[model samples]
Target: MNTTPDSIRHVALSTVRLPLAVPISDAKVFTGRQKPMTEVIFLFAEITTEQGHEGLGFSYSKRAGGPAQYAHAREVAEGLIGHDPSDIAKIYTQLLWAGASVGRSGVATQALAAIDVALHDLKAKRAGLPLAKLLGSHRDSVRTYNTSGGFLNASIEEVKDNATRSLEAGIGGIKIKVGLPDTAEDLRRVAAVREHIGPDVPLMVDANQQWDRTTALRMGRALEEFDLTWIEEPLDAYDVEGHARLTRSLDTPIATGEMLASVAEHERLIDERACDIIQPDCPRVGGITQFTRLLTLADRAGLDLAPHFAMEIHLHLAATYPREPWVEHFDWLDPLFNETLETRDGRMILPERPGLGVTFSDQARAWTTDAVEFGIR
Candidate 1:
């Protein structure tokens, strides 16, 4: 086989094993849930060009079942070997169709998403441009919201305290978790938080798929007096009709789709007017390439794009999209990464460095144990 510096050469994939305890506090959970500790699995892909430039990307598996996620990543990696790292879209399309028989959504798409991100990272590095600039330079800074310090297990007082602290930290917006033992009690907690934060600061609430449509509508109406920014995932994630009903009945906007796996699902939600704001998690969606497409879809539909998590990637997407209001910030897993995403005055500055502009620290690597590498050509 012949290879040139600018030509497709070899691709290597590896798994960096890192374990995270239950209750990812600073986002949701206050008292910290009991045992059955959770481990975060990161799928890292290194794409090498004939020129010797290597690009890196990562995927996370945080569910109770790990075998399936591991297998999915490995299978996708096999298809990515020998593909040009610069052809990010082509590779993504190939992996997307490779799993077509099983459907191009869910774990399969998520697996592909990780690989796509790594390829984009590599492509950006080769081009010597930040991912945001490569995508489209719309803004130099991206606004952010605090997803930490919400603590579902914390007492009302403690929740208030955390909210106050986040405000003091200069976050323009804050998200809190609801849907507890009783709807009435949940409303009370939300009301107390609203009172503490005052009316000027934007407030969003997430139910984490805990309530049904009726409950969501009732709660939405009840919380109208408090002026919530949005009610997220109030029903099952796949329940587009339920979300539409809730959106129609409530004064507050309905926000869902973080669990969504494809643009098709998002199109359905947007076409139906089910959600006012679209929240796509880069890892859960199909990475940056697809995310840029999704942003376009939302823009045409006149909907807002506020990414779910992965602030590092979201910051870039938000900076490129221009209409994205905020990127959710939760620092639980950041320690495992090499670089920390900077946030100040409720905004994040898009890194000027090439590619994703972030690296995984040795300290973060210490969290890894067993490893698996793939994509050798």
Candidate 2:
């Protein structure tokens, strides 16, 4: 399966919209009639070589811009059509400069990320190895923390039920959403979840950057008794000094960086001691090429890795992290892909199949609003 730039022939972009099982409310967005945040936008890319090999990858945004990401991916595809997928760094650099004017963080970087992931998937498949094995695996299984059960829109009873189910199904860590209007209610919910999951299991909370310096410190102190594993994004993503202050003031580890766009930003967080646990989302940080760089940074800084979302992509990358990795668990994506990630003894067992070990489900294809191609004859 030798492929060169000449052998690389076609690029395709598509989109699918999937409704959430239950509408999720975070600190910022509540999904109701006026807000109407029901469905998520999925933008996908498919790369095919002259040898007839294909790789699949996708990216997402919460409520807007499925078409924009798809358009950007299509625009990026023009620069990629004649380039070998094996030349990941070369392609990534080309894409970076291609979108330099747009500031390369939000949609531009996300588009590059989609292409990078598909290239890796294609390379791993050609080699007949899983992506983790291709990257080098530190462990066969990575520990998972369930996030689906803890959105702000869910009731306390719903949260408790979700936590119980996650534990009963063998996952050991549960993270719930905090940062509601009332800090007392937040404390109460955390305490209830902690009690329900028991004394030994790890309980974490995400404030989703909803708090200021003072509120974060107050809530961190109030919920300290519950023995949270970490408090996520208590302050705004860019507030390095505030995160550092909260990290120093609290006994529980401060975990942030899900929203950061670049390694330099993460370096600022690390050098400033902004967080104890560092989380990098692969798609958000321009895919594996950039993600691996961040992993090395976390290793040197002696920080633990807990990647943000899309466990399908993170689970493999997490296996290679220097420290024990905590991969987030969200079932919202289950319907979009064909394969199911297995969780046993609170750990995700990596799939043995080549590449990402996934393809779009029939349901996902049915939801696709559009698909277009470049370089295909």
Candidate 3:
């Protein structure tokens, strides 16, 4: 096993689209209204090495606009064929800039994200090390906070019940959705959840960009009694000035950047002090390459880095950067992968296996209806 640079031979990219239909729990609705059973789609990326090792990565997206994502994955994969899979940063930048004509952010970044994760997995497999080691190991565990275990659409009893279950499960903190019909209702929900979790456990609220500046400020003021850990995306993602104003006006730290697509946007947020925490998602922020850069920017700005989602990948990044407070927890999409990461007592144990230490399950791949293999030549 001569694991030298020359041992890396070839790379290929392929996609499998998994279709799912799941019920929205009482605690997971938007605007206090529960929608009917909705279809969820997940995209999987497979990267192969000449040495016969392979790795898988995935992204979760709503079903309505999935074809666009599939197309974007194919377009980005075109640039990955025949390249050295070990060069994660180089390949990431190629796909990132390739779609510059269409815009560097959004779908382009997501496409790059999937490929980047897979390539890292491939590299890890080659080196016989875990992704955390490949990324620069620090702590073997990362803290996690519950997301959407408490819903705005649920009754007060239901909300409390779910919050209780989440806390009992060992989650250090819980995040609830707010900003539905009115600010008053939002305040009530936050207060109820806070009481359910008690004073010791941390609580956070995500508005999902549902409120304007005035309403956000008003709600932020009202939520003060509940002792929120952070107020997430209370205003439009692009409204940097409004975020800055909201940050200054509120006692709670304003948190955002999940919707951001590039390091430059994150830098702008940091430069303006628009948020106390920067949440860059691997799939949304141009993959690990950009995410590492964003962490650097956060370090420079004296800000905290709490990645948006993709806990498995975020765990590696969090371990790499000990300053990150927490990684979001959502288990809905875990089954779609071949190998899944585990969380115990509110802490994620970094995968010690090489690469991502996870693979797509056969059942998960069976759910993929449209399978497209790129770079067939």
* Residue 283's lDDT in candidate 2: 80
What range of 10 consecutive residues in model 3 has the weakest lDDT sum? 5-14
**Between which residue pairs do clashes occur in model 2?**
none
Best by TM-score: 2
Consecutive 10-residue window with the lowest summed lDDT within model 1: 25-34
Put down candidate 1 lDDT per residue, 1-377, tens digits, no spaces: 23443644665555566655344432223223333334566666666766777776766666542445556767666666566666778878887777777777677777676678877787788778998888886888777777666757567887788778777766668888887647777888888888888898888998877777677778888888888888888888889899988878888988888988888888898888888888988877767877887888888888877888778777878887757567787766677667777766777778888888887667656755444564344
The superposed Cα distance between candidate 3 and the true structure at residue 204, in angstroms, equals 0.4
Against the true structure, candidate 1 reaches a TM-score of 0.89
For all predicted structures, in order, the TM-scores are 0.89, 0.95, 0.90
lDDT of each: 0.74, 0.86, 0.74
Which 10 successive residues of model 2 have the least lDDT summed? Answer: 28-37
Candidate 1, residue 101: Cα displacement in angstroms equals 3.3
Report the CA-based lDDT of candidate 3 relative to the real structure.
0.74
Q: Write the per-residue lDDT of candidate 3 for residues 246-281, one digit (tens) a residue.
A: 988888999999887788888889999999988888
Q: Which stretches of candidate 1 lie over 4 Å from their true place?
A: 1-5, 8-10, 21-37, 374-377
Candidate 1 Cα deviation (angstroms), residue 127? 2.1
